[model samples]
Target chain A: MPIDEALLERMLLRESVSEFLYREADLLDERRYTEWLDMLAEDYQYSVPLRMNVAFGETDAREETRAGREICWFDEGKETMSLRVDQLNTGLHWAEEPVSRISHLVTNIRLDAVELPEVAVSCRFLVYRNRVADETDFLVGRRKDRLRQVGDSWHVVRRELLLDQSVLLAKNLSIFV
Target chain B: MTTVEEPTRTGAPQVRNLVDVKNGEISREIFIDEQIFKNELENLFPRAWLFVGHATQVPEPGDFFSSWMGADPVLLTRDDKGELNVLLNSCRHRGMRVCRYDEGNTLQFTCPYHAWSYSIDGSLVDTPGALHGVPQQKAAYGTNLEREKWGLVRAAQVHNYKGLVFANWDPEAPSFDEYVGDFHWWLDNLADAFDGTEGGTEAFRGVHKWRIRSNWKFVSENFLGDTYHGASTHASVEAVGIGPGGKGKRRHGERQNEGGFSKGRMKTSFRRGHGASDNLAYEIPYPEFEEAELDEYFVAAWEKRKEKLQAEGRLLGGRGPATLFPNMSFAAGFPRTILVAHPISPTETEVWRWYLVDKSAPEKVRDWLRHYYMRYAGPAGMTEQDDMENWDYATEASRGVVARRYPYNYQQGLGQETASDLDGSVHSHHAIAGEVNARAFYRRWAEFVDNLSWPELTELARVDDRATERDAVVTDVAEGVKVLDAVDVVDGPPAQ
Candidate 1:
C-alpha cells in the first residue's frame, strides 16, 4: 500500500493527544492534585454551568446558565482552582478528610478543531466517588476543552462542562470531576 | 410514653409529647417519623407563609418563575399591570403541569394534555392566571365546565417584602408582617443595599438547587443559630482561607477586634420562630479585602450604610446568618444569599439557593461577589460541602432502629435567655454557643403541627415565657443555673 505522509502525521497526533488525556485522568484519580494542576495552563479557565429545563427551542441558547454574567456551579481560574487543591491537602477538610475513592472515566474524546499549537476537544466524563462506608455518587457530564501544546506536553487552557442534571443528584461536588 | 397511631390521631397531643422544649429534649421521631411529616404538610405548610421567589426574577409582564411552596408547585407570574401572582402550576382539567419550564415569559400557559389555556394576558381576563380558553368548550363541556371556578388556585396571600416574595395557602394565616415580627430587621439587611438603601438589591440570574438525603429540619436547624458547629464542621475551609482577605484569614475575613470573631456574637431568637445567629449590638464591619479595589468598594459602602442607618436611629448590625421561620434562611453580608429547604419527605429535602447582589455594583464588584458566593455557599462550595457530608451521615446514623429510642439534646443555653429589646423575642446570653434558637424553632414547629389556631398561636407567641423568667434567674454559666428550678439543665444529679 502507498504510504500517505499527511495521514501518518494525523494518526501520530491523535495517539499523543489520547495519551495526554489518559495520563491526566490517572493524575486526578491518583490524588496527585499538584501534578494535575500542572497540566493546566496558567490562564486556565473552568466552569460548570447550572443546567435548566428550558423550553424546546430555547435549549440551544438558554439550557445552561451563562458563565461570566450569570451564576454557575463553578466559575473560576487557576488561582481558585489552586485553593481547592490546597483545601484537599489540609487533611482537615471534613468533606474529603477520609479521602474518598474516586475514579475519573474520561472517554469519547474528539478533536473538534486543530490549529498549529492548539486543539479544541470534546469528551464525556463520568466521575465515580465512593467515600466512607458505602456513600457513593456518580457525576456524568460533557467536558469541552482547549489544549495548548507546550514542547512535548499539552496544557488545558479552558474547560467548560455541562452536568447532565437539572437538580444536582450528588450531595456535593467535593472531589474534582 | 406511648406513641399514638398517627392516622386518625394526627393532632397536638402526639406532637406536644414529641417536643419537650422546656426540658430541651426532642424525640428523634419528630425528625424521621412519617406521621409527623404528613402532619407538617397538612397543618404547617398550608398555613405558613413560605418563601416563593424574588420580585426581580419576574419583573416584566408575562414573566413567570416556577417555584415550590412545600409540596405544591407554584408559578410566580407578573401580570400586564405589573402585579405579581402566585398560582398553582397544575392544570385544573387533568392535573397536568401547565408550565414545565423553570423560567420563561409567556402571555398564557397552555396545557399540553388538554389544551386548556390560562391567560396571563390582562386583556383576556380580569386577573392573570384566570382560565381564559378551554379546548372545544362548546363541544367538550357543553356549558357545564365553569371557567370562573377553574382558575388556577391562587395563593390566599402573597407579599413582596422588598424583593423577597412569600406566599400563604390559608387565608387564616397571619400576615407576613406579624409572622416575621422583629425578624424583619434581618430581612431588611438582606433585601436592602449594603448602604441601607431600601430594596436596592436583586438576585443573580441562577439559583443553586440540589437534593440531599437529610430531613429538611436539619437544614433549618443548622442555619437557625447553630453557630456551635462552625469551629468543627468548617475547620478545613477556614484553614484554606478562601475569604476576601485571602490565605490564612477567616472565611468572613474579620478585621480583627479585641474579643475576636465571636466578640459580641449572640443568638436572637423570636417566639415567632425566626432566628438570627448575629446580635444587633455586635457591629462587625465587612471584611478587609486583600484586593485593593474590593476593599475600597466595601469600605465606602459600609461607611455610607452606617451614616444612613445611624441617621435613622437604626442599628448598623443587622448582618445575619439568619432563618425566617419554616424554611427561608439567609445571610446579608460577605456572600449575600437566600436558602430555602423544600421538604420532600421525612428524610429528603430539595434545597434552593438564590444569591443577592447590589444592583448598582460595578461589573468587577458584582463578578467578585458572584465568584465568592459560588465557592462559599452551595453544595459545590468548600465551606458548605462539609455540611452536606455531616447532614447526610447524621440523618443516616439517626435512622437505625436502636437510635430512634433516644432524643437529641437541645439544652445548650437552657435558661440563659436574656430579655430582648424587641417584641416577642429573646437573646441567649451564651450567644455564640447556644441551641436556644433551635429549641424555640422546634417548639413553634410542634405548635403549628398540632394544628393550633392562628389566634392561639399568636397569643402563645405574644406571651413568651423565656422573657418573663429573665427577672429571677441569675445565670452562672459554669454552674448551669437554669431559669426554672423545675427544669435542671445539665446531666449531673441537679444544679445544686
Candidate 2:
C-alpha cells in the first residue's frame, strides 16, 4: 500500500507541536506546576532512568541501562506526580522551600512519526537551576515524548529522559529538568 | 594591639583535651581544625575498615567500580579468576587516575596521561613504547625496572560482610571480625539470607551520591545517637503529610515520653565506638498515597524472612539508625540502607548511599522499597533535606573564635547507661534523647588521635557496661549533671 505523506506531514510537521513544547518548558521554568499538569494526559507516565558509564565497546549497554531493570531518579505515574506537585504547594518540600530559580532551555524539537491522534516527538533540554547564593546546578538531557492530541492541544502521554552524567554532582534533583 | 593567647595549638588536640568525659563535652577543633583533618587521613582512615563498594556491583570478571577511601581514590575490581581486588586508582607513573569513569567492565585500564596499562588484577601489563621513549627509563629508573615490581598498590586487607566490601590500608590493623565486634548480631538483621533466595541482601543498581558542606563526623554521630532531632527537624514533612512521618504518624508522635521512657527503644554501644539506636518489633505502615496492595506484598515478604530472623535471634521488634565506627552508618528500617561518607576536607564531605533489598522478595515489593528509599533518605529525599540543613549550620557555627572555645554539650542521659542482655554492648535505656553513644564515639576518636596501640585501644574499649567507668573524668570543666533535661529533648510520644 502507498503511504499517505500528506496526512503524516500535516499531523507531525505542524508548527503547533513545537510551540506547545516551548510553552511546556516555559511553564516549568516559571514554577507554574499546576498549569503545567494540564498538559499531561490522564494516563501519563514520566521517568528518568539511571545512566551507566558502560565501556565504549560494549554492545549490550542499551539493554543493561534501561528503565525498570535498574534504579532511576524517577519512574512516576500521573497520580504520583500530582501528589508531588501538591506537596510542593504546601511550602514544606524543604528541597524547594526557598524555591529554585530555573531556566529551561528547550531546543532541537523534532517530530518523528505520527499515528492518528498520537505523535512521537524528541527534543534537547538544558536546565540551569540556582538555589539561594553560592548553589547552582546545570542539567543537560534529551527527552523522548509521546504526545496525544486532546481537542486543539497536545498532552504528554509518556516521557523518557536520558541524562549525560552517570553520577549526579548536584546537591539534589528537586527541580524538574 | 593587646596581647592575646591562642586558645590552644599543637597541630591536633591532645587526647585528654579533646573530650571531657564527666562533663560530656566534645571539642570544636576536631570538627574544624585543618591539621586535625590531615592527621585523621594518616592516623585514622588507614587503620579503619572503610567500605568501598558492594560485591554485586562487580559480580563478573573484568567488572570494576571507582571509589574512594578518604582522600585516596581506589578501584574495586573482580579478576578473571573471580577474586576481588582493591587497587589504587592512580597510575604508578605521573600520578594520573587510571580509570576516569564511575563504573564499567574492562580487562585493562590504560592511563590517559602516559599509556601505562594495568590488567584486571592490577598488574602493570604494558607501557607504550617504553624502550624507545626514554632510554633513561632503564638508566634513570635503574636496571631493576620490572613489570612484576610495578604492580598497583593493593589494600593491606580486603573483606566482605554479606555483600558490603571493605578495605584497610594498614597491615597491622585488626581483622574485620575483631573490628566489627558485637555488632554482628545487629548487622544480621539488615543482611542475612532471603526467604526464597540463596544469596542475602544486594544493593540496588545505582548509588545515590551528593556533597554536603559539613564534617563527616557530624553525620556519623548524628545517625549514631541523635534521635531527639527527628520530630522537630522533620516537622515540615509531617505537616506536608509525606515521608516517614506521614506513613508512621502514630509511631512518630507517641514514641517520645518526656523523661525518655520510650519502650523497646535503646542505644547499644559496641566495641570500637560502633553503636546503634534500636527499636524492637518496628512496624512499616503503608502510606495512604501508595497502592493498597503494597502493604499486602510487604506482609507476605516479611512473614517469609521473619522465620529465619527469629531462629537466629536477630529479629528485632523495632529498628533504627546505627553507625559502624568511623564513618559508615546503617538505617535498619524498611528498605535497608547504608550511608558512607568520604571526607573531602575539614568542612566538606561526599556521601554515598546504597539501598539493600532481599533478592527473594516479590518484584513489586522490591520496586516499592526502591521508591521508598529514594523518596525518604537520599539527597533529593524529603527527610534528608531537613537533616542536611542542621548539619551544614553546625559545621559553620564551629568556626567562630569564641564559640570554638566552649565545647558542645553531650551530657543528656550521660550517667544513665545500663547493663545489656547483649554481650559487649553498652546499652542506654533512653531512646529519643541520649549522648551515651556519641560519648563512646569521641572516646574512640581520642584514642586514635593519641596514637594508642591496638592492644591499648582494645583494653580501653573494654569497661563495665553498668556504670560510667570509661566515661569518668578528672578535669575542672566537669559538671556532673546526671538526669536528662526537658529542654534537651524534642521527640514526641511513642505509637499506641
Maximum-lDDT candidate = 1
Report lDDT (CA) for all predictions: 0.84, 0.69
Find the candidate with the highest TM-score and give its number. 1
The superposed Cα distance between candidate 1 and the true structure at residue A87, in angstroms, equals: 1.4
Q: What is the C-alpha RMSD of each candidate to the true structure, in Å?
A: 4.4, 6.2
Q: Summarize candidate 1's per-residue lDDT along B368-401 as a digit string, tens digits.
A: 8999898888988988898888888888888888
| Sequence-dependent TM-score of model 2 | 0.84
C-alpha-based local distance difference test score of model 2: 0.69
What TM-score does the A-chain of candidate 1 achieve?
0.97
Per-model DockQ: 0.86, 0.38
Off by over 4 Å in 1: B1-13, B258-260, B470-496
Candidate 2, residue B277: how far the Cα is off, in Å: 1.9
Every model: iRMSD: 0.7, 2.5
